[model samples]
Target: MSRSVAGPEIERLIQLMARLPGLGPRSARRAALHLIKKRETLLGPLSDAMRVAAERVVVCRSCGNVDTSDPCTICTDAKRDPSLIVVVEDVSDLWALERSGAVPGRYHVLGGVLSPLDGVRPEHLNIEGLVSRASEPGVGEIILALNATVDGQTTAHYVTERLSHLPLKITRLAHGVPVGGELDYLDEGTLSAAIRSRTAF
Candidate 1:
């Protein structure tokens, strides 16, 4: 059988930290020790922030974003292009796009992609909301910003089909060679995509 070196409170902290993505038992242990050592500077603030987030964070009803508001700042922003909607697989993707400042309009988070093997179906995602939003008169385009993985492509195709009936243009994030990337380091898919998506100089 295993043993407990610390009290239940400290051990519980380690267990909880281990649940975070990219954190395993050893990493969690190190993190827990760091937090404990810096309790006054890091742990207290983090705990308070978590408490506030738990209390106030809400899933936006219109776009499925997590924020302190229902519609979220993005959905309510008057400056955002109402004619375009960038569809992403998750809030993380939405944040990434926001950081890049490449998206020209509001966003619709699908919550997750369609992974039949993982039992994630259309009903499991926010596809119904997307279709409903796409039906609106002002929405003229939908840009699928999903990853290039098989599951991501599958989900994008499914979403395209769902929104096809609407009188709106649909686009996807272009796949190609990345800037400053060596040709030899890239895989076949990237090289092929770069050739297929070649643009004018």
Candidate 2:
């Protein structure tokens, strides 16, 4: 089998799309072709949306979640409990927790876990922000909703160690999180079970 050169512009689009998570060269090419076929409906709008999002999206000042504004809607929501904050590794995990509707507390997105192999370190994440949040006046507990991977557990332990001085009760999600599984992939039932059965660290 042979593939034709998709011209420079299409090739550029394919390259950019291929860089996205879960998108390979073949998938990127297919998506690019689809976009080209429906340029008015899909490609043009997608290009404009991506440009706008790139310009406006910024990290939430409080929780590090990606938002169009500095203090994201979740961080500014007055109805959320200040006494309980769920710590997650990334925005996707935070969104997963929200979808489950298990915790009503605020969230602190760590940006990512500590993965030494990938050159991710404690300082690279929002560990200091988490520790500071734990020591804040109203915080009583911190639910570590990180993934169940080795790196996730290691990051959790590191966070726990950093906040040992704070009075807040530290807890980890229960074993409903499958070994090497991310929070985003778990079902609502499984996520609920994990939260309910969360043990003290």
Candidate 3:
């Protein structure tokens, strides 16, 4: 018969926080305690920010990226190359690529990869939107930056088949060993991909 430490409100907050990604019950309890201690400085401001984000944050209709605007900053940026579009599985993937600063073009988020076992299909995803976007003029190439999983490759193949009639070049991200990875530590799939995609040196 262990006694509960906090009141209903605090316990509710901790429970809610625990539902967030990467935060478990123990971490959520610690976070809730910290927030309670810093009610005025951290907690209040965070609550306000979350409320504002909840009100303003929206999914970009065109590209499927989450943003405060419809077209999103990436879509509206004039400096980005309009001829190229990198297709990713989610907004998180888009953000990862943005951090790299390697892509000077825009992005198209597919919402998710094709997973038949998980009941995810082409109709459930933004595949139609992608096809429509690819059909638009000034779009020359589409780079698929999907994960190297079976679902990701299946989605890529489906998209490629759908867009085959369109006069556009479709490509996928290159797979290989990491920059400093040793041969002994590398997996067979990675080794095969590295060999297959080897460049002329």
Please identify which of the two predictions, 1 or 2, would achieve the higher TM-score against the true structure: 1
Model 2: worst 10 consecutive residues (lDDT sum): 1-10
Please list the C-alpha lDDT of all candidates, in the order they appear.
0.94, 0.89, 0.93
Residue 93 error for model 2, in Å? 0.5
Greater lDDT among 2 and 3 belongs to: 3
Q: What's the residue-level lDDT of 106 in candidate 1?
A: 96
Q: What's the residue-level lDDT of 104 in candidate 1?
A: 73
Once fitted onto the true fold, the runs of candidate 1 whose alpha carbons sit more than 4 angstroms away are none
Backbone atom clashes (below 3 Å) for every candidate = 0, 0, 0
Over 138-185, each residue of candidate 3 has an lDDT whose tens digit, in order, gives 999999999988899999999999999999999998899888899999
Best by TM-score: 1
- In Å, residue 151's CA in model 3 sits off its true spot by 0.6
Candidate 2: where are CA atoms >4 Å away? 1-4, 177-201
lDDT (C-alpha) at residue 136 in model 2: 82
Ranking by lDDT: 1, 3, 2
Error of 1 at 141 (Å): 0.5
Candidate 1: pairs in clash: none
Q: Number of clashing pairs, model 3? A: 0
